[model samples]
Target: MDSAVGRCREIRLRAYPDGMIQPSDLTIIETALPEAGPNDLVVRNRWFRISISTRLMANPDAQAVEGIPFPALRPGDRLADGAIGEVMACPPGSGFEIGTFVSHPLGWRDYAVVDAGSCVALGRGPIEPAAYLGHGWTAYAALTRGIRIRRGDTVFVSSGAGAIGSMAGQIARRLGASRVIGSTSTPDKADWMTAELGYDAAILRNRGSIADQLKAAAPDGVDVFVDMVGGEQLAAAAEAAREGARFVLLGALTAELNVAGASIVAPVQLDSFQLILKDVTLRGYSADRDSAEAFPEWIAWQREARLHFACSTVAGLENAPGALHDACEGRLRGLVMVEV
Candidate 1:
C-alpha cells in the first residue's frame, strides 16, 4: 500500500497588541500529513488558500483582533468561509470525487481533510475561483447593502479603487446611481478607476480638505457613503452626507492600522452637534453575521445585482507569509489566495 503523507501549512499565533500584524505574529508550521479519518476526503495540494480572515487570522483570541476569545476557531467555527484545493482522493462512499476542486475552512495548509459535510463544490463562474474569495464576495456584500442607488442620487465611495470599493462603485452605477464619486489617496488610483473601470468621477484625497472635495464632487450632497475604513472618513461621511443620508461603516482598516495618523484619527470628533442633527444614519456592517435564510436570500439576489471581485493568487504554500505581508502593506488588494 502507498504510504499516505500530507504537507500542511499552519499559522501559529504569537502576540500582537497594536492591531498591526507582525511577521512573528504568526508562525507557519509545515507538518507531515495524516491519513483521512472516516468520511473525510484528502485534497491533494493544488492551491491551498488565502482569505482576508484566514482561519488562522480568525482563530479565537487572535491578539491582533480586539477582544476575541482565546483560540478563535471555537467549536462554532464556520467552514463555509474558507476555500481549498482539488481532491486527491476520498474514502469510498465519500461524496467528493477525485480531482474536484473545493473550498473549505481547513485553510493555511497545503493539504486539507474535509468531511463531506464541511465543504461545498465550487460553482462555475466567469472568473477564476480564487478571485471569488479574494474579491467577489466582499464586493458582493458591500454593494448589496445600503441606501438604494436610485436615479439622480449622488453617491460617494471611500476606498473607491480598493478591492471591495471599486466593484461597489460599478455596481452602484448599474443599480442607477446618477453620479458615482470615488475617493482615493492618490491620483494614480483615481485615474485607474476612471480610465479603466468606468468611474463617473474621481477625487484625490491629497487635494484640498476632503470635505471641500466632497462638496465640489457632489454639489447636491452625497446620498450614500460606502465607507470601508472608518476613521476621519466616518466623520467625513457625516460632514458630506446629504440630509437623512445613510453612512455604511465597513472595516476600520485605517484607524485599525495606523492608529497614530491624525489624518485618520482626528476627524471622528465630529465638527459639531449639527452633524448628528442633520438626521443622517450611520450604521456599521458585518456581512458574515447573517440569518439562516438571509445567506441564501442575498446569494440569490446577487445574480441580479451583478457584482465583481478581484484576487491576487500565490502559488506554493510557503509563499503565504509573503502574500500576507503584501496584503498588510496594501501591495495586494481584495482577497489574497494561496494555492497549496
Candidate 2:
C-alpha cells in the first residue's frame, strides 16, 4: 500500500434534510482505513452511483428500501450504493488480485474494506469500467422476468432518459418489440430518446397531460409498459394500455423525494373498471429477485455495442451530495455518478 493511502475520506450525513436536500446535510471527514480482515479486499473506489434512491435512503423517516437490506440512514451514518473500484490489497485466499476491478456495495468513500464474497470482479473487456455502473440488468429483468415483452409488442418506458429507462428502451427493441416508446421530462430528452435511444416515439411529460401525450404517442395502445415514474404516468399508461397489457412498476419518482417524509407510493387515479375490462396486469418490481440471469445476455449485447451508457459524472467525492440532490430533483440526465 502506498504511504499516502492510509487515510480514507468518507461522506457522512451531517443532518437529515427537512425537505429538499441542501449542501449542509452532508459532511466529509478523513479517517484511517480499517485493517483488512483475512477474507477482505481493500478497494479504492473509482465511481459511485447517485440516484433518487440515494435521496430516499437519506431520509430518516422514509421506509426501508425493499431488496436492499440497508436500513434508513440517520445523521452521522455513511451512505452506500453500487460502486466500482480497483482492488488495492487482497488476502491470500481472497481469489482476487491486486489491480483487479470490482463492483461492490460500499461507496461514498475513497476506499472500502469489503468481504471478497461481496465483490464481483470485472474481467478485462472492451467496455469501460464506467459502463458496468449502468442499470441495464434492472431494465432487462423488468422487461423479461416481470413483463416478458413479446415480438411486435409496443412498449412504453417512463423516465426514458433516466438510468434504467435509457436502457429499457433499447433492450425492449432488442427483445423484439416492434415499437419502443418513452416518456421524458423535457423536449430535449424526448428528442434524444428517439434519435439516440431508438425509441419509436417519445412523450414529454411536462408539456400537458401525460395521459393525453402518451395516448397520442401510442395511438394503438401499448402492449407492455415499464413505468419508473408513477403518478400521472401510471394512470396514463393504464389509459393507453391495450387489452392484456403487462405493466411493471419500478420507481415512483413522481412522489417527489424532496418532500418531507417522502414515501415510495405512486398515487394513481385510474378507473378500476377500465383496468379490469382491459385485463391489465400490474406488478411491482422488487430488486431482491434474481437478476443474474439477465447479466450474460446484457453483457453480450454490450459487447456488440447494442446498448448505450448514459450518465453525468461529477468529479470528487465531496460533490456527491450535490449531485445526488440534482438527481433527486431531476436536474441531471441518465445515471448520475460521482468519480471518486
Compose the digit string of candidate 2's lDDT tens values, residues 1-340: 2447688988888998878877789898898888888989999898888767766677767666556445688899988888888889888876788987888988889999999999988854334654567787788778878778889999999889998898889889988999988988788878888888899898887688988887787889999999887888888888888999999988787774526555665577888898999999999885335566566676666677557777889999989988877877777877788989
Cα RMSD for candidates in order: 5.0, 2.0
How many backbone collisions does model 1 have? 13
> Could you tell me how far off, in angstroms, the CA of residue 16 lies in candidate 1 after the best superposition?
4.5
How well does candidate 1 match the true structure, expressed as C-alpha RMSD? 5.0
Off by over 4 Å in 1: 1-4, 14-25, 45-81, 91-94, 123-127, 205-208, 259-267, 271-277, 291-308
lDDT string for model 1 (108-191, tens) is 665677787877665323325544344334444555653445576677878777666767777677767788888777777677
Alpha-carbon TM-score of each model against the true structure: 0.77, 0.93
Against the unseen true structure, what C-alpha lDDT does each candidate score?
0.60, 0.81
The total of clashing pairs for model 2 equals 0
Best by TM-score: 2
